[model samples]
Target: MAEKKWMPRWFYQLASPRWCYQITGKLLPIFAVAALILLVGGTAWALIYAPADYQQGNSFRIIYIHVPSAILAQSCYMMMAVAGAIGLIWKMKVADMVAKACAPIGASIAILALATGAIWGKPTWGAWWVWDARLTSMLILLFLYLGVIALNSAIESEQTAAQATAVLALVGLVNIPIIKYSVDWWNTLHQPATFTLTERPAMAMEMWLPLLVMVIGFYCFFAVVMMLRLRNEIIQRERRSSWVRELISG
Candidate 1:
C-alpha cells in the first residue's frame, strides 16, 4: 500500500526555483490570453454598449480604467508588503524577488489611477488637480512604492537591500486604510465608492458589469506581468546555477 503524503507534492516543489520558473512559464501564456480577451471585450462593452451617466455624462466612462487601476495599485502594494514580510520572516529569496517585482508595477498602476483621476476631474470638478484627502493619500501610496524601489536600488548588498525594502514596505501599509477611508473621514471632492461589500453597487448592472470585467482583466494582466518579471529575476539571480545554465544552453 502507498503511504499517505502529509502535504501536496506541488507545495514542496514550489520551493525549488527551477520548478517555479518552469511552472510560471507554462502558466504565463494562459494568463496572457485571458487578459487580452477580457480587456478587449470589456473595453468594447464599456465604450460601445454602456450608456453615458446622466450626471457625469460620457466623462464617467473613465471609471472603467480609473477604478480598476486604483484597485490594482492598492492590491499590488498589499501583496508586495506581505511578500516582503514573508521574506523577512523566513529568509525566502523568492518572496524577496516577488516583493521587488511588485514595486515598479504598483507604482505605475498608481500613476495611471492618478492620471485618469485627473482627466476625469477636469470635466467633472473643473480642475486639473485637487488636494482632496483620497487623492493626497493615493499620492503618498505612490511615493511609498517609489521609496521601496529606491531603497532597494541604493543598497549594494542583496540581503541588506531586501531587508531594508521589506521594512519600508511593511511601514507603508498604514497608509492604505487611510487612502480607503479618506472620503468618509473627510469632506472630499471625490465621490463615494461605486461598489461596496455591504450594499449593492450604486451604478446599474449595465454600467457595472463592464467595469467588473475590466477589473478582473486588470488583475489577470498584473499576474501575467508579475510572473514575467519574476522569471527574469530568477534567471538573473540564478545565472551561475547549473539548471539555469542548462536552460540557457537549451
Candidate 2:
C-alpha cells in the first residue's frame, strides 16, 4: 500500500515554514471562527444545560473544562517531545518551530488543570492541595515544561536553543508515564475518568455529552492557538529567507 501511493516523495514539504505558513494561513481563520463557535457553544451547553452530578452537584461541571484540559496538557507535552525528537533525529527546522510553539500552550493547560483540580478538591476532599502522587507528578510536569521553555530562551543562538530544548524534552519524557499511572498506581484526591462511554460514565448522558463537546472545543482552540504561535515562530526564524520576504510583501 505504501508503494502504490501517487503522492510526491517530498510530501513532507508541508513541514517547510513557508509552506505551512501559506497553507495554515488559508485555514487559520476558519479554525478561529470554528473555535469561537464551538468553545462558546460548548461552555454554555456544559454549564447551563448539563444535569448536576448526584455526588458533587454543580461542582462536577468543572470537569467540563478541567478533565479535558488536563488530558490535553499531558498529550500536548507528548506532542512537543515528539517534535523535539524529530528535530534531534532529522534536524527538521519546523520540528523546533512546533516545539517552541507548544511550550506556552502546554504550560497554560497544566496551570488550568492544577487550578481546576484545586477548585474541585476543596469541595470534594475538603482541602485545596495535596501531595498525592498524581498531584505531585502534575506539578513536576509543569516544572518540566517551564524548564524546556526556559532552556530554549536562555540560549542566544537559535540552533543552540533548539538543541538544548530538544535534549531537555527528551530527558523530561520520564514524567509522562509517571503522571499517567499516578492516579491508578496510588489512591489520590483526584477522581479517575468519569465520562467513559465504552466502559461506564459516572454521570448521565446529559452531563457527559456536553462535557464532550467542551473537550472537543478545547482541542480545537489548542490547535488554533498553537498554529497561530507557530506561524509567528516560523516568521521569526525564517525572516532571512526569500519566502518570508514574499510573505511579508504579499
Candidate 3:
C-alpha cells in the first residue's frame, strides 16, 4: 500500500493509450503556435537581418534550413530507435506506434538535408555530388530510415514488424557516431561542425542566433507532427476500445 501510494500517477497513466491521445491533443496546439512563431520569425531574421558571411557571402544563408533539418534527421532516428527498444522490451504499443510514425518524418528531413547540402555544395565545392565521408554516412542514414520503413511495410504481423525494425534501428545506431565524426576521422570535403557543445560557436552571434531560433522551431515542429501522428496511430489501433468508440461517437 505504501509503495502504491508512492507511485507517481503519471507513470501508470503513460501506459494508457487514451490518456496519451487526450494529452497530445491538448499539447499539439501549443507546439503548433510556438513552431509557427519561431519558424516565421527565424526565417525573416536569417534571410533579412543576418549579415552575409565574409567568405561564403549570401550562399551561407542556406545553413538556416540545412543545419536544423540535419540535426532533426539525426535526432529523429535516435528517438525512433529508443522508442523501438522500449516497445521491444516492455511490449508497449504506444512506443511501437511512435517508432513507426518517426520513420517517414525522419526520412523526409534526411532528404531535405541532403538536397540542401547538395545545393550548398555547388557553390562552395564547385560540384553537386561527392563521396565525402560525412556525405556518405548521411546517405547511409537516409538508407537506414528507408530500410526501417520498408521492413515495417513488408511484414504482416505488427509485433514482428516492430521487433524487426527495433533490431535494425539499434544496429543503425553505430552509424550515427560515424556520421557525426566522419569529417574529423577522414579527409573530407564537408566542413566540421558549426556549433559544438564543448566550445563557442565558430561563427558570429549575428549569424548563429537565427539558426538557434530555427533549431528550436524545428524541434517544436517535430514535436507537433509526432504528436499528431501518434494520436492518429492510437485512434487506429484503439478503434475497438470503448474510449475510442465513444470519442468517435461523440
Candidate 4:
C-alpha cells in the first residue's frame, strides 16, 4: 500500500540527499517569510514593549537575544549529533548533508550566545568573562561546533568526515547537561531560567511575555537559516545529479 502520511515512515529511505533537498526546498519560502515577520516583529516588541526588570532595569533586555541564542546553540548541537548518528549508522546521504548543513548555523548561534552572554555579564557580574560552570560548558559547546565544522571541511570524503564529526558531537553531548544545570549545579552569577511562557515565570508577565516571543522568534529565525544552509548542502552533495542541475538552472 502507498504511504498514508505525507512523509515516509522509514527514516533511512528518506535520507537521500535528493529527498532532503526537495523537502527543504518546499519548506524554504514558507519558513523564510514567516521567520522574517516573526523575528523582526518579535524583537521590536521585546525591546520596546517589554518592561525593564525590577532589579536590572533596561539592562535585562539582553535576555531577549542572549537566552534564545544560548538555548539554540545547545539544541543545534544535539540535532547535528542525531543527524551524524544516522549517517554513521545507516550510511545515509541526507544524514551527512544535514550534519554538514548544521555546522555553520550552529556556530553562528554559539557566537550570538557568547557575545550576548558577555554583554549581559557586564551589567550583572561587572565582568565580561567568567569561568563559571554554565559559561565554561557553553564555551566548550561552541568549540565543539567549530571542531565539527573544521573536521567535516578538512576531510575529502563525506562518509569519513561525517563519521568523525558524529563521534565528536556525541561526545560533546555531556556538555549539554552541564550547560543547562550549571546555574543550579554551582555558585555562579548567570541567573536561573526566567522567561517561561507555557508555565509561570519568576518575574511578572509585563517583563516576561516579550521575552517569550523573542524565544519563539529566535526559533523561527534558526529554522530559516537552517533551510538556507540545507539548500546549499543539497547543491554541493548532489552536484553530479540531475535534480541539482535543474535546481541550479532554474
Q: Name every residue pair that clashes in candidate 4.
A: none
Residue-by-residue lDDT tens digits, candidate 2, 25-53:
88888888888988899889988888887
lDDT of 1 by residue, 59-172 (tens): 999999999999999999999999999889877788889999999999999999999999999999999899999999999999999999999889998889999999999999
Poorest stretch of ten by lDDT in candidate 4: 4-13
Candidate 4 clash total? 0
Q: Going through the candidates in order, what is the number of backbone clashes in each?
A: 0, 0, 0, 0
Number of the top candidate by TM-score? 3
* Cα lDDT, all candidates: 0.92, 0.85, 0.93, 0.83
Candidate 3 lowest-lDDT run of ten: 6-15
Name the better of 1 and 2 by lDDT.
1
lDDT of 4 at 152: 84
Residue 22 local lDDT, model 2: 80
* lDDT by residue (tens digit), candidate 4, 152-180: 87998888888999999989988899988
| lDDT computed for candidate 2 | 0.85
- As a TM-score, model 2 comes out at 0.93
How much does each candidate deviate from the true structure in C-alpha RMSD?
Answer: 2.4, 2.0, 1.7, 2.3
